[model samples]
Target chain A: MTQPTLGVWDVAAVSALLLINGALSVWLSLGIARQLLVAALRMVAQLAAVGALLTVLFGAASPIWTLAMASAMVLFAGYEVTARQTRRLAGGWGPGLGTATMALAAATVTLVALVGPLRPDPWHEARVAIPLFGMILGNAMTGVGLGLDTLTTAVVRDRAALDARIALGAPRFEALRPVIREAMRRGLIPVINAMAACGVVFLPGMMTGQILAGAPPGDAVLYQVLIMILIAGATGLGLLGAIVGGAWRLTDHRHRLRLDRLAPARPAS
Target chain B: MTNAEILTLRGLTSTALKDCNLTVAPGEIVVVQGPSGSGKSLLLRAIADLDPHQGAAWLGPLDRARMSGPAWRRMVRYVAAEPAWWADRVGDHMRHPKRAAELAVSLGLAADCLDWPVTRLSTGEKQRLGLARALEDHPPVLLLDEPTAALDDAATRAVEALLKRRRDDGVAMVLVTHSDAQAARLANRRLMIRDGCLRDAVS
Candidate 1:
């Protein structure tokens, strides 16, 4: 069944339904009316902008443009990941490592999807490639960021134990075994939880979008599952790669943990 | 193994020590006495290669330059005042569980206590167990920083006796302590750190 399209007046009439919540918030003294309105406005603006850009790109369907857009998105994602870290590598190493890892993970997974499963008529179809690239890179970025943050914080907080392990004849990997394990576990948790909740608790965003755009529920569900699997794989690999790279930068050839390589974290409020 | 090797540090400089030169032969115990925050612990850490420093340290003919950090640490063990144990089970940290059990028994810990979680251990118990863990490696030289500070008289005596046994077995030791009696009892040579300079303690 084809879903009915919402024109300008239809969208406006439905958007006005938010006024009911705004009135309720005012009556309850919630003070969230302004925030609610501002958030809705920002969401509209961002989505509209992305929609326009996607429209143009999909029409052009140029592989070069698609690649360039994917690169830009991955670069931004990398920057966001590094920026979110509480304790990151000093100088350019943290961002550089994050960008490289994210790019590698996202590109690898997107290519596999494009060539292996999706197998679109034209290999670099903008609609298929861009969204897949964005989803993979976006999830991988968060995973890498979480892993780096957790490992760095663990290093600083459990420094005494780490040194003690080293002093007790443990090699570098052995000394960091616990922290590394915890970091990777924390990194992979988001994707794992999303996978668990996808169909049972709530329909995932990708599946909902596809169903809303007139795809069959079964097809959307299958695609969503496949995408989640790819996300989990990419995120896990990205986290492991980024953490190992960051860890290497934090130590020397002699297996000494060099705190100097880390930017000092600000004290929590 | 080799008879009575020496731990020699020459021109060693760290946040705690400056151009420090010292040597302790196997079977010798050098007690370092100093005021609080006098870098006594840092000196021990420097010798253990846990901290960055200038100058060279040698375990007999083995130079610090020639050995990996872990290898150097294994030969020269540093037991901090507050020991850090990463494992939940005490036995997990011991390289030699049987030797650890023997040391634990001598240090007034039950042999089965190794299987106990670290959270179940008291401060004194943990400290004593930490000593056992370090000694399990059978380091040639031991750097001790107030190792018995948290113990009572009986516990302190138990630790002191175990250390004395290690000394008799030709394990060179640098012991940093504030206890004058401990210094008096254990020192083959007593040195005091004042303003970062090592000098002979006043008799």
Candidate 2:
């Protein structure tokens, strides 16, 4: 059975609940009334636009259309990754490295899931492939972004120690081992926490959405488990690629710490 | 052109230093004296291959460019003016704790100083330990920047004596110092740097 559809009035009724936030801002003199209004409006408009695009994409149901949308999402995620950094790599490497790693990891996992387990009639079915790709890409992007930021920041912070180690005859990778481990830990912690807390602490958004869409709870639970595993795999791969690639970029063949390759850190805002 | 030189720099140029040439025979110390920000540290860093430079440095016949950075650095160790210690405990930074403890005692550090947390170190104590860490390996060449800048008269003498012993063991050195008296006591040849240019200091 299909889930009940949401009408304009039903959406408006929920939207009106935001008035409580606006009223709270006004009463508390929080000075966030305008910001709250603008943010809510932006969310509504953006989601509405995405919904319209998805309707057309579902109607087309072509692999090319699905892949095109996925590419667009990955590109946007790449920008987000770089934008989130405090000290980005100099040159276009910040965006280039993030986009390349995220795309490689997320796409690989998504393709494997589509072909192996889901086995949709058309393996690249827009509905199944796009959402799966999107979910994996979102998590992978966050992991890669955090990993890269940590790598660059740590390299700068530990410049003297790294140089000392290098001077003491340690190989570049050996000298960077501590920083790389820290970056990997930072990137993977969120996914690990989410996995641990999924059923007991909170139902994941994907499973909640699936249950609301009238799917069997068992099926939805299985989907959530599969998706979570895929996300973890993608995030781990992405973080490894990004951090390793970053390490390579930050040092030269001479094994000197190439701080010049990093943009000077912006003063803390 | 003789093979007697353990370390040789031919036209080394860094961003802060102009083209420079020098050589140090085994058991010799070449003291570099300069005002602050006059590229003394940069000169040593370039020789150690820590900074990018435009010149050739040879450890005997082995050209620096031909060697891996770590291998080159291992052979030609550069101990910074304010050395960095990575680990929490003092002994963790040393490759050989037994030998380092011996060296530390010679440098006027307590016998148990190696077991002390790094946070407990005074600047003078850290300086001595940093020297001990570098000397533990007995590299062929030492590029030392102000090795005793933080030490008092007695501690400075202790460090100088240790450096003299290293030299007597055939380790060549390039030492940066601000004190003329220290240079006179340690240097086989003294050079002064100003505005990135190196010139022999009059005796």
lDDT of each: 0.87, 0.90
| Candidate 2: segments with Cα more than 4 A from true spot | A1-4, A267-269, B1-5
Q: For each candidate, what is chain B's TM-score?
A: 0.97, 0.96
| Model 2 lDDT per residue over A199-249, tens place | 999999999988998999999999999999999999999999999999999
Docking class of 2: medium
User: Residue-wise lDDT of candidate 2 within B33-133, one digit each (tens)?
Assistant: 98999999999998888877799989888988888999989889899888888889998898899999999999988999999999999999989898899
- Tally clashing residue pairs in candidate 1: 0
| DockQ metric for all predictions | 0.68, 0.77
- Clashing residue pairs in candidate 1 (N, C-alpha, C atoms within 3 angstroms): none
Indicate the TM-score of model 2: 0.96
- On TM-score, the candidate that comes out on top is 2
Model 1: DockQ score: 0.68
